[model samples]
Target chain A: MKELERVGLPTVHVCTIVPISQTVGANRIVPSVAIPHPLGDPTKPLEEEKAIRRRLLLKALEALQADIEEQTIFGN
Target chain B: MTYRVVHYINQFFAGIGGEERADYPPELREGVVGPGQALQAALGEEAVVVATLVCGDDYFAEHAEEAVDKIIGLLESYRPDALVAGPAFNAGRYGMACGALCDAVSKKLCIPVVTAMYPENPAVEIYRKDLYIVETSDSARGMRDAIPKMARLILKQLNGEPLGRPEEEGYIERGIRVNIFRDRIGAERAVDMLIKKLKGEDFATEYPMPSFDRVPPAPAIQNIREAKIALVTSGGIVPKGNPDRIEASSATKYGEYSIAGLENLTPETHETVHGGYDPTYANDDPDRVLPLDVARELEKEGAFGSLHDKYYATVGNGTPVAYAKKFGEEIAKKLKEADVDGVILTST
Candidate 1:
């Protein structure tokens, strides 16, 4: 993500481990669901899981569209 | 029993000449040369400075590969058990030569190699990971102090003795983690640290975070409706069978899959090879890791302009920072050429 940002391409990282993302110098971050399944929750119904993933991606997209001065993790 | 040691020094150190003779070509001499006398005295009778390899700083810097090859060739005949390079002080070129020479000797000749330089020496950043470099003062005035530490370290290495921490051994920290047993359990230690922290007392962390490279945030996407966004992942999501064969851990390569027509990732169409986590969750539904399903949905709903046809994937489990940076640069270059305006990098 740092490389992408260096090359003028705005990037956002979606991951469960926000501290690591911050450490790696990610400029824009959005927390994901969990480690094994970052987007979908197996316990949820297919539709609900899809909703969860869509919400997360929307947050990631928002991060890309929104300017940040420093490493910022979009609150869940 | 006597241990044989080879010493490397720059043109300035050999008393041949200073800046003018910085172009001196590599030369091999019979025994102790200049500073080697001091090193010999420090090594005592246990180790003998078998020979000295001298080279001009400019010559070595300009022709590094050849210089290393030539020096290693000269060193092979000596059959030295260990090698010592100058306490280069703060001389950038000299420190570089010593670091490079020591690095090559240790690798090619399988000998213990040691050098000393000021902590701020530019070469320390480049070669500290590969050499045992004792910290030194900025000038020859510290030679007396530096030589003994260098000798002790090389001797310890030659004897196969366990080395203490960098502070105790008088060497710059190499940032390498060594596992050692502690009397107190981790929870107890954590509590102790917490109490110290709450009391404003000093405490050291067991694991120190390495400094990282920071990049200024790029300007926000101005035209979200027309931006060409790309998806990149360190989640190890790839086509079934992993055609690129990216390692399950410590991946050396990344896979670029054509998601041109793919609306979603199914277990049959995609799977994850990341070894850091249980694959059952990811393999059962790769979209859980890559999120292409929801991404496609957003694209269809006109939430964004378009998704790039090609998506990059690599396993992040235990991958080296150097390789990860390399992969990121390459991937970003291709994305830029493809006119990708933004990216969503998913990590698992």
Candidate 2:
């Protein structure tokens, strides 16, 4: 991500709930609820999971399109 | 025989007051405050807390240079042999203030500085290298243990003795790199390790692992509506039946699947065979792993010019750093060819 960013390509990261990426310097991050299933709760109904995934994904896309000067957190 | 020491504390710890007193500018007072007594007691007769300075967290953060200058001015008169700040524990702002102070003191005064905080504190990365940082619990409950370690490190600096590793000294790992002479070759050690592995014998690793220095975040994209965005992942989602046959683990290759006019990813058309873990969820409905449904929705919302017709995928677990870099560059080239202005990379 850093390399791509250096070359002038915009990049937003979708990461797990873990805080590791925040420390490693990902400026735009959207936190997935868990490690194995980042977009939705695996235990929920398939349709319900799909709804959650769509919301988070839209937020992530919005984050990429938005202008930011410093590190920004998107959907938590 | 006495070694003079300088103590740094926030307004609350300095005994000036609480949140209301947080604006208390940097003031130097002779003698110790609360924890300074415990620190002095631990330092014994060899070290004395000669001067103490207190400032508010908000004030210091808002006026870092002014605070540092004021504190440095006060320290010039005392010239302590060492500086010790907070065992800030879980207080984010206080921990950061202590780190900032330690870094400033070491750079300006050219004296050893030490402090302690929990590993989770955000300040660990800020000043771990500028000073000796002893690891402490989330609260002051471990002060008895943390202070003794700080005192020992301070004493070592005063006596010019070699400082040991964090594990040996019971301090927090400062994440500083130092070269040390080793007794044997890593290859030979690896062979021996392999032999031990075959024999199931316990053996120490010859080459210790290095720490990771994370890069700072990059600036965000300016225009989503005008930008052509691409989707990338290490989740290993690919065309049905794994057409590209990308490896499930330690992948040496990556695959890109087209979604030119696709509104959703059905299991019949897309599936994930990543071997890192069970792919039951991803295989049932590829949209669970790849957000094509959402991407199409956003496209309708005019959030971007268009999601790239194709999205890139790879299995990241255990993939060598070199290969991962190569794969990223290759995929980036593809995206560039398609005039992608930005990327949203999903990691699983």
Candidate 3:
């Protein structure tokens, strides 16, 4: 992701483990769900799960459009 | 007689409890525990797991130094030839404990140690440069493959054998620039690489360019009074005498201190232990770096609902990025658990 960003490509490093990604120096971040299934949890109902996935995808798009300087974290 | 080795595992693997029991503290027991049993079997007659150390993820995060010290004392009494930590897979805290302990064991006890975890296990980034970490699948489904690989690497370390490339050995890259005497010398190697690059036929570069990765910045808080804010810093401020002994530089640990009843930081009560810069000013007025005094005043003025009683501190100078990330995650979780709605991170 860093290499991709370095070449003037807009990138958002998406993951459930924000701290780990930040430690690796990931520039743009979008916090997803937990590690196992990054977008949604199985414990949630099918519709709710879909909603979770949809929400994350929206956030990833939001992150790409956002501008940042220095170490910054995106997503709730 | 077999190679005596100590095993480390977390509470969940030990069958003690799950998240509810995550504050179970540290304990030492005879014989192998959950994952250790598999490790012992893989080790075969060449090695024996003499004892197992179990710790809760929360407990270790809360009291790292004390827990590590206690575990080390237990390990010293056993006098094991080597230490083997988990095939922790994707488990974050377990992987961290294993990585931190293995690193400590290697440095303090002067012994070889090995741990297995998923490549993204967080600990890999922190301790990999100082230890050998076998790469494994993200879940325990990869156990059968991981055990053998970890055992092979640990045995190699025990016997002081030479290791091949990371791909060849199934271990993650440690990012250390090793000086090896090449068969053809630097000029020949350079020419060979140049020709291969010009050919553009599956050429591999010996050096890769470095890139910096940063975050996009989380959204700012909307309401002040409704938001509970926690304070975090890499400024190395602590109670007088530096109780946690966080290193002046190259810190491996962090401290969480409560400011529940305190309104301002006094010179006699707090001081800066960081060695990278002048500490006189920070010592004279600890708030200059930590900003507890201003934070309290801001709270009274309703800039935020309430300040978290506890503030997390760790020395940033010379600290590895991995450790810094670990501290941040753990402290963030603690603050979140305390119902903190926002965080105020101050750095020196």
- Give the winner by TM-score: 1
Candidates sorted on lDDT, descending: 1, 2, 3
Docking class of 3: incorrect
Native-to-model Cα distance after best TM-score fit, residue B307 in candidate 3, in Å: 37
Q: Which candidate model has the greater TM-score, 2 or 3?
A: 2
Q: Per-residue CA lDDT of candidate 2, range B183-286, in tens?
A: 99778878989999889998776455544344444445677677788888888889888888899888988888888989988888888868886787777767
Query: In model 1, which regions exceed 4 Å deviation?
Result: B1-6, B15-20, B28-41, B44-52, B72-81, B89-92, B106-111, B118-130, B137-144, B157-162, B173-181
| Per-model TM values vs. the true structure | 0.87, 0.52, 0.50
Off-target runs (Cα >4 Å) in candidate 3 are A1-76, B180-203, B214-348
Please say which candidate is ahead in DockQ: 2 or 3.
2
- Candidate 3 per-residue lDDT, tens place, B224-317, comes to 5666666666668899999999999999999999999899887899998887766766676676556676567667876557878998888868
Docking class of 1: high
Please compute DockQ, using alpha carbons, for every candidate against the native two-chain complex.
0.87, 0.29, 0.05
**Model 1 agreement with the true structure over B42-152: per-residue lDDT tens digits:** 999899999999999999999999999999888888889999999899999999999999998888888899999999999999999888999999999999999999999
> Candidate 1 versus the native: TM-score?
0.87
Cα error, residue B305 of model 3, in Å, equals 37
